[model samples]
Target: MPVSEKTADRLAQHITGGFAHPVFDAQAIFRAVMDAMARPGTVQPVKLLAQPPQPLSPVAAAIALTLCDHDTPLWLDPALRQTQAVASWLGFHTGAPLAGTPADAHFALVGDPAALIALENFAQGTQEYPDRSTTLILQVVSLSSGENLLLEGPGIERTALTAPSPLPRHFVEQWKQNRARFPRGVDLILAAPEGIACLPRTTRIRLSEG
Candidate 1:
């Protein structure tokens, strides 16, 4: 259906600024995201090139604008999906299709970490095509150094410690199950006002010792 002029104007009003230099900005953000994913639990700052809607953080907005496109199927959490302005702005800016279920989403945008659905609910690509698994972009309260969890994985030469902002109940237990999926699990990008952190499927996580 064709959007009315009034609706278009409203969507446009909330459409935040994208990369000043699309190529360069996207490359920079992509690199940052890649680096964070490579080194799990490390916090990295993503420059806010765009001003997204109310519930979307600068970091989360940057990720969506950088990674999402017509080919990607995005799923918004209830909080974000409830806002028509956010949906319209995303449609106008990214042209990414909205998925009806988590399993269908190539990317899932979650505004409230505590309210996020189970990791198992999303697509966990087949062993033959693990690259097709879903990637979650979660907006959290903060990302700072506090050393609440220990991380060990391919990227870290030794164990690394990190403290992500508060997460949903039973997150660690859920993570263990997600990790058990091996080559077929979802990856995560946790975005905060300060920066973003990654949790690739391969990373081994455990609560820190006293």
Candidate 2:
């Protein structure tokens, strides 16, 4: 049977690979994300789920696929935005729109942690709707290799310590400010080759004393 023209066109399109088992994979990644969010400082493992092109780590891509959707506007850092592959893969898989500015993003992905823009530049939800703030997922070298961080707040029993490598520029100072905002601040998800760790806005962060 001769293939229809529409079918032929679809077949010829070079679709970047996403999750092989979309439903199961997304569910597993989602669970990992929730675990990290709830624990605040513990790194939760996520099996490799996607193979997005350069600059977009597999873990970051999987998180985007699992958490983002058409309604969520996404912002990409300069490194990731330097090429079209990362954005194209995300848009194709998640249907998320590219936000023109960081302040407008519902979610933002940073590929270069050390050079990341200030957290305050992104969406900080108002007091009336705290959940409207931006959630940033940063691609870093490792979840366990960076400077030690002392954590204390809700979800923590007393305190927790985490070291996510190549810490963002002025992260310690920035986090204190973010915490001070209380119900209005950006939450962070640090993604590494091994897994992910979260720092919800309610969590207090400071450089650990030697």
Candidate 3:
């Protein structure tokens, strides 16, 4: 079907601008994401990218612009997928292929944390190629210090803390299963208006008691 000029214009309006300087902007966002992943539970601020559709945080938009491309298969939850503006924007900017199922996605974007799909539903890379697992990008209400989860693992000197407001139901329990998968679980990037935090497959998490 041919797209009308009006529809094109509306789509364009939602398509956010990529980094001001593609190379530099991408490099900066990449570094931020990498650092967050390396130092699990640490929040890293992201430079603003194009303003994406609703439910797509500035940080999530930045990550998509920085990391996704035609080579990656992206899966958007119903909240994001149902919006043509979001689909058009992502298609125009990242050129990432949309996956039919979570297991086939290299990256999965979840706008509603409370309604997130099961962790096991996504790709868990095989032992011989553990790095191929899906990397979940979740948009949360906030990433700040409050009720937190104690994190411990390769990156922590002792233990680190993270509190992504309003996490998914049984998130800690699900994380335990994800951790038990060892070299075969999905990694995560939690995004908020302020910034982002990561929970790689190697990180260990537990609820912090009051």
Poorly placed runs, candidate 1 (over 4 Å) = 1-9, 145-147
Clashes of each: 0, 0, 1
Candidate 3 stretches with Cα past 4 Å from truth are 1-5, 14-16
| Cα lDDT of model 1 by residue, 94-204, tens digit | 899999899999999998878888999999999999988899998888765433878898898899887776576678889899999999999999888777789999998
What is the lDDT of every predicted structure here?
A: 0.84, 0.88, 0.86
Q: Per-prediction RMSD in angstroms? A: 2.8, 3.6, 2.1
lDDT for model 3, please. Answer: 0.86
Best by TM-score: 3
- What TM-score, to 2 decimals, does candidate 2 have? 0.92
Name the TM-score of candidate 3.
0.93
Q: Per-residue lDDT for 1-210 in model 2, tens only? A: 999998665443315568999999999999998999999898889899888887788999889999999999999999899977677778888999999999999999999988988888999999999999999999989877788999998889999999898877888999999989989999999889989889999998888996
TM-score of every candidate relative to the true structure: 0.92, 0.92, 0.93
Number of colliding residue pairs in model 1 = 0
The model with the greatest lDDT is 2
lDDT of 1: 0.84
Candidate 3 least-lDDT 10 residues: 11-20
* lDDT of predicted model 2: 0.88
Residue by residue across 31-109, what tens digits does model 3's lDDT show? 9999999999888887676577766777788888888999999999998888877877787888999999999999998
TM-score of 1: 0.92
